[model samples]
Target: MMNTDDVVIHVKEMLERASRPITEECCIYRVPLLIRQLNQEAYTPKIVSIGPYHHNSLHLQNMERHKVMYLKSFLERTNTSMESWIHYIASKEPLIRHCYSDALQFTPNKLVEIISVDSGFILELFWTSNYGTDDMYLSLPWFATTIFCDLLLLENQLPFFVLHDLFCLSVANFGNNDIPPFILLTFGYFQSLNESICLLIQCHHDLRSLTNFYLCGENKTTHGEEPMATNSSVNKWSEAGIKFAITKAMNTGKDVDILVRDGIMENLLGDSDAAAERTKRLCRNIVLSDFQF
Candidate 1:
């Protein structure tokens, strides 16, 4: 008979081969085992190693402090009683295990990178003590969902629109596609206005003229009522490009409103000066002042 571990490995291999583009759900437990197998040499060190613990003491302490700050903010903002949040945590403990297991599939360094980015946003937004009971209290499960969604985007498995919809639903209802979805989510709650505005401006930079918003028929085509064209154009900015523009703007302390009014993003998004002016006029006239989503 085959060894049990061998059998399990074979089974996982079969399952993986059967599936096209393994999903988050598919790689949940299998990834950790694969990592262990792949890193047997590194992991087989002296069982009672002391260097990592001693050397990384300060780093670990900093991380713990950061987690505490994030938890504090989340509890305060959601007005969740400490006990209630703890209870919710207990309820969703299994899911957390799955997430960690999923994370372990990648190399430790890759895992750290993802966690750092995801947790940084959480800490930045939620690391505070002042929160109201009336505010929406997202549970750890919801937060995990956000993390997974972000991971999908980072991997390019899902598009921005998917994440945009999820954000809208979590924060507010998404209505018709009149105004941009980011704008709707931002304006829905006043407390989040600053963060929302930042995301909206980032999204505006990401937009490539809404290629899907096209008119149908040739001669007497209806304007603005047509579906998106089958083919869409993209004007994606490199990560370095985004960083440079944002850094320059932040250093100048310029208002984003002025940035748009002064036509800064036009060059950044690869629009000619003339195209930028015409597009701005089109946006002013065609965009609904009170469009919801």
Candidate 2:
């Protein structure tokens, strides 16, 4: 409906805007509809929502009190003032917001508050789970199990750096040197899920990124000539004179290397419930990466 002059002016404005520097790339993403549709509950958080994406949902409101309780305990144990915590997280607001894929509509103060409370709760929860009294919340039947599973959900994650910053500050304040590394605590917490999948998380920024190490592996390249895609199961492969031998070392470093030496396929397999799911998802991702899904 506009004239040529108006269109030209609008195009020029758009081009100018596009030329500005992009401050952040999207890191968080919604689970693809295809994946979500397959298992609606798996991707959904049952107990808590950690970031702006799923913050303050009606069903998740019960956990809000728990978060506050944990925060209070954290403050008491660390003996650190709340004002200092706020200032530290407030300084990292822009960087933290950039971790999410979408623009957070909350005010800067609200965003800082969310990050501070959530990160504090998580750090405290981890510490308590490892070293607290036997009467803590984790002692509830199936409570720890459900919460650990919820934490691993994509939508129920806080940026790992936020957690690390708070943890370091707390440790510095309390002069406590006994806390284990975050990755080790996390792996220990969820070890029941997959003991065989050795997680070597280095320089990861979030739980989702850490989990990807298990699902997709470190390397993308196929080890040798790509196996021909055929309608063959492991049993069928065995019938075709292919022998399957389980590898002893199930390291993340060798996750994607499928070896075929002398008609033997040295495949990797895990023996836990979580490992079974990871194996299926890993194969699906590998095929999808090859443009075959």
Candidate 3:
């Protein structure tokens, strides 16, 4: 049997032999098998796939043509050629692939194709949702909400830089007297999903923090805050007519007092009661990992 240090050396050497890099830029991740097994539908995309992870899933295919249609509209409206964008994306091949935790099996060209169209669709979404549109997808409230939910999923994301670069690239094309920062536009996209929910983040002011709430979905547990009840316990409490309400202060981190939050309900769509249970269960049987922002 190998001794402790020998075993450690062996593991290190094996990692070196592997092609995967130390992904410091790695933020996007596939939902772990254990976590995905919790409630598959909550994490999986139903309406649209934004990134390479679920790029051509069969059920998600129907939205493909719509993405292309949105891309076409974006190009025509901006009169921006795809050639420059393609070159820009192609040059970032390694960095883009590194953003996801796993190695991307896609070819360089295929990866660029996926990012270009998907990012274009998202930028167009930010535009139409704010600027006004008669587009069929944006018009249907339910479908629009589903699309917004998918955008927030862990696996369904392009790197933030890719999105920021494209947003800046298309800014002048919009011919705006004043264009909001990309971070604000992103929050505005989330706000548009539910007119009832207002993301009053203007005063918070850090670009990084503003994007963290939605982009990464990293619910940072505070020093004293945590789950006092298990999944079954939370469900039982709700069943006993113990209604959970928003904290009067409405501050950060998990407020254990309110077991189910609108933030959770919005991301995991379902029947009201069912949504609450599912949201509470998200923390059950899961240990927080150090590998986060």
- Which scores greater on lDDT, model 1 or model 3? 3
**Weakest 10 consecutive residues of candidate 1 by summed lDDT:** 46-55
| Top candidate by TM-score | 2
Give one digit per residue, the lDDT tens place, for model 1 in 221-260: 2455663331121121122222112211221213233344
Candidate 1 global CA lDDT score: 0.32
Question: Could you tell me the lDDT of residue 72 within candidate 1?
Answer: 55
lDDT of 2: 0.64
Deviation (Å) of 145 in candidate 1: 24
Evaluated at residue 182, the lDDT of candidate 2 is 74
lDDT of 3 by residue, 1-293 (tens): 74899889999999888875546677777788887888888788988998899997999999988888888787777777788678888998888888888778899889999999998888788878878887975679899978877887878888878877877776767788688877667777766443434343432222222334322322433566654332234344445554443222112223332444434224334345544455455654555434221
Taken over the whole model, the C-alpha lDDT of each candidate is 0.32, 0.64, 0.68
Give all TM-scores, in the order shown. Answer: 0.27, 0.70, 0.69
For model 2, what is the alpha-carbon lDDT of residue 14? 92
| Model 2: residues with Cα > 4 Å off, grouped in runs | 1-25, 134-137, 200-202, 215-231, 234-293
Compared with the true structure, model 2 gives a TM-score of 0.70
